[model samples]
Target: MFKKRSLWISILVVTLIIACSTSSSSVPKLRDKHHQPFSSESIWNMPIGADAQYSGAGLGQAKRFSPEINYYIVTQETDPQVPWYFPQNWGVGRCELGGRQLGKIHVRADLIVPDATENKTPNNAAAFLAPDGETLIQLNPLTRCEKGGPVFGHPTPREENIYGMGITGGQGGSGLSSIGGTIRLGELLPSAPPIPHVLKLLVYAHQYLYREPPGYRWPAVRSDAYAYKDDSPLRYGGSNPKLVMGALLAIPPEMREDDLGLQTLPGKKLFHALQDYGGYIVDDTAWDNYAIALESGAETEFELTYGYSFGKNSGPFYEDINQLFRALSIVDNNTPETLGGGGTPRQPLAPPIGN
Candidate 1:
């Protein structure tokens, strides 16, 4: 009787396990409200009509455009005059005004090119402008040739110095790349200064060559390619200033958990500042890349030259930033404060041999 009872119990346990597994399997998968099934190729081949839209309360109005109208520019050198690829005005609504109530904005992008531009191919064409006068940012090609050739008007040569704040590394990597590229208008804008809402915007331009259905195959021009000419008004330094300004505005500030005024209390101030306004998206690969850059010292180099210019930081700020990372658990290993460092050293080192 004892053995029979034990066997029944085991069978019952097995039955329960099977029932639970079946029930769980029968349940449907859950997706985010904005979740869309997309492969790199499918997204690349989608037409302008399929592109996403952006609008919000604070933004003036909702706007829509063909995906082809989105532009990204890549350059070999840093050119202030050249317009960095960023969406200006598509679907931005006015939400808020002061302090932390600045309001929210929405942005979307499609992968396919619209049929309208198929027949009327313009020479030296870069990107299409929205009928409402919104400029589509373009990705410049990086090549060694002069004008009129296949590579004419492409991005700067690989050897040229490149600079940008967010996405410093090339695509599929971290930060921005040495080669220039376009940023979707929605992805460019900073989040509301004080709000905690998380926004995810799609960039339609990068879909050009990667998406399917009408995906461009290998040996085809890179979807990110563009023309580069020294004297051309379209050059990075010579592109439309308004567009450049728009691109700058589109870059979202880093997200922070505390109010901006509270940032002055010290301890992780710089790290929080970076998280709040430096365009690092929390929980995303870009954020990890930024942390890696800081740890590897690339950010230090970047900071020394352009840190202050961007209003981000100065010398020794990395240590403070690292501390912030530690507090947030973004990084491991706490660096002890020491003499010549921000915090006092636990103990003094022995006197120098020469001294």
Candidate 2:
């Protein structure tokens, strides 16, 4: 009867929803140079409402960004010329991050390791999607003396499932993924589309170390508790009370690139994406620089193809990056419930989730 039909309709609708949620790109996402981390519904991929609540303290005004450096992102597929390994188990060495103990883990898939030259950065962090396509494997202090052999690094305390909420990951004092929010390979090229997801940010968590009142927010497991080195000052510790680890820094949806007077194409692209998707505070620079993490070789490709360098203080990236940071307002109300806020989204929901 009519009731039966209605019930069937409801069941059908539910099935469709599940299908949408589980359908992943059939193409091997990681083998390619494209793909962003996390699932369709991931907070990193969601756009905030135009009216999302924010704090009045702008990052630029606070001088929170360190203009000196932009961190690089190392990923599984970064260097195809180099060999890759699928180790049976990941090694742990007093590993700890994002308030979780990397020392304890029960992962089932092979740990994806790269044989490329070990990244020279101190963080030496690298992330790759496990073969299962469900787990995001992170390697901090990833190392390999020989280019084609055994791999070594600590597995994260809490490995994120891309199909799930993806609220947390394996690295950072903030419990964020070294790869999540990192600017993907071609995102900044002149021919590329506007960035489509939240970017990872590193603040100058320096000697003047301070965090938000409660330390961190959802998605972030904790904050930078390392108040200061064993020397110097900072007996009376405190928080910024304005910014936190998990907080999103975004352009109010109502604002346009024109409002910020962004002139460079690169800046305009970054501006639009940042306004729509915002960015996450993933780590601390420990120095005087605010940085956005980028995929390996991303900078090199950009320089060779785009004909500019971030090193130049007068370049478009330097100008726009500084300008955008200054205009950013903390998405203070961003939380599990209000992640995208209440206003209309700038982009469609990310592609449906699935392995």
Candidate 3:
């Protein structure tokens, strides 16, 4: 009798498990807002920072924002010049006056080519070779704002640019690669949340610190694993979208969970800042660690309002966010090597030395 009862209970439990998985499989697509079967490649399956390491060995000093956190202030400035790869009017609507917030970032712009109608050579036509030497990826008509088609999922090849749901801005793990500027207190009436909403991302042209992009192959890197003359990683600095994505994935899931992670007041606030407010990635190398964009008279406004509330470190914001991420292992974007296990990074084995 006892054996029969156990057998029946086991069968019922298996049935319930199958039912639950089948029912919750459909997720809404951002493009049509219609429910679609979750594909094997969905971004949901990909880990955060699915691209590259979060921290690099060459970024130099780390800033401690709290007792438990330390960060690299990658870039902070007002009115910096945009990178050459970015499209004109890239942030026209997205980074407009009222839209400064987290996940807000700049991106590489489409190149303008010479129209056959005109006699002269096109201004900024550049050649981009694919990872396979034989295929040349066309950059003449590369798009900054053009919406992409549905992304099958994350871990999409760097070669095929298509990302999730076809929405250009939201799906690409590229956006999460870097953080951007937002309204500061006493600077043109701050926004409601006081910062841009989380997940909005941006990237401007700059250099990366490493000589070689460690994680994976890049379009411009040579067969010898060195950068081409026109795209030397060392001379131009560096930015690896993959590295940033990988770092995001390394963040503890518990940190995101209200019930399991982040229970303390500061921990909760910091988690919200990272998960919602957003954090910056050292996508490209720059003169100073922080590079904030200034246009639309923002630079002048910041200068004029200096004595007021918006000066550095005066607002409620924490200057160095990398500190909050210290709970995870420090990922060295500059190093191609991996530790802890395969491509996946494991929890830090020991407390940070010299802490």
Give Cα-based local distance difference scores for all models.
0.23, 0.60, 0.27
The C-alpha RMSD in Å for every predicted model, in order, reads: 22.9, 11.0, 16.7
Instruction: Give the C-alpha miss distance for residue 152 in model 1, angstroms.
Output: 9.6
Ranking of candidates on TM-score, top first: 2, 3, 1
What TM-score does each of the candidates earn? 0.20, 0.70, 0.30
Writing each residue's lDDT as its tens digit, candidate 3 over 1-355 gives: 9999999999999999989878777543232111111122322211233333444222322222211000111122231223223222222221122321222212223222222222221111112322332222222212222222110111112222222211111112132211112222222322222222222211212333223434223211211222224464324334444333223223333454334344333334434434332333322221223222121233345446433221243332333333344443333342223321225422112111120
Q: List candidate 2 stretches off by more than 4 Å.
A: 1-34, 61-120, 207-214, 228-239, 353-355
Candidate 2 per-residue C-alpha lDDT over 194-231 given as tens digits, one digit per residue, 9 for 90 to 100: 78788877665542224324467777887755543345
Which candidate number would show the highest TM-score if scored against the true structure? Answer: 2
Output the TM-score of candidate 3. Answer: 0.30
Error of 3 at 267 (Å): 8.7
Candidate 1 accuracy as TM-score: 0.20
Lowest-scoring 10 consecutive residues by lDDT in candidate 2?
93-102
Model 2 has an lDDT value of 0.60
Candidate 1, 126-243: lDDT as tens digits = 2221222222222221111212212112221122111111122222211122212222222212331221111111122221112222221211112222212335332222222111
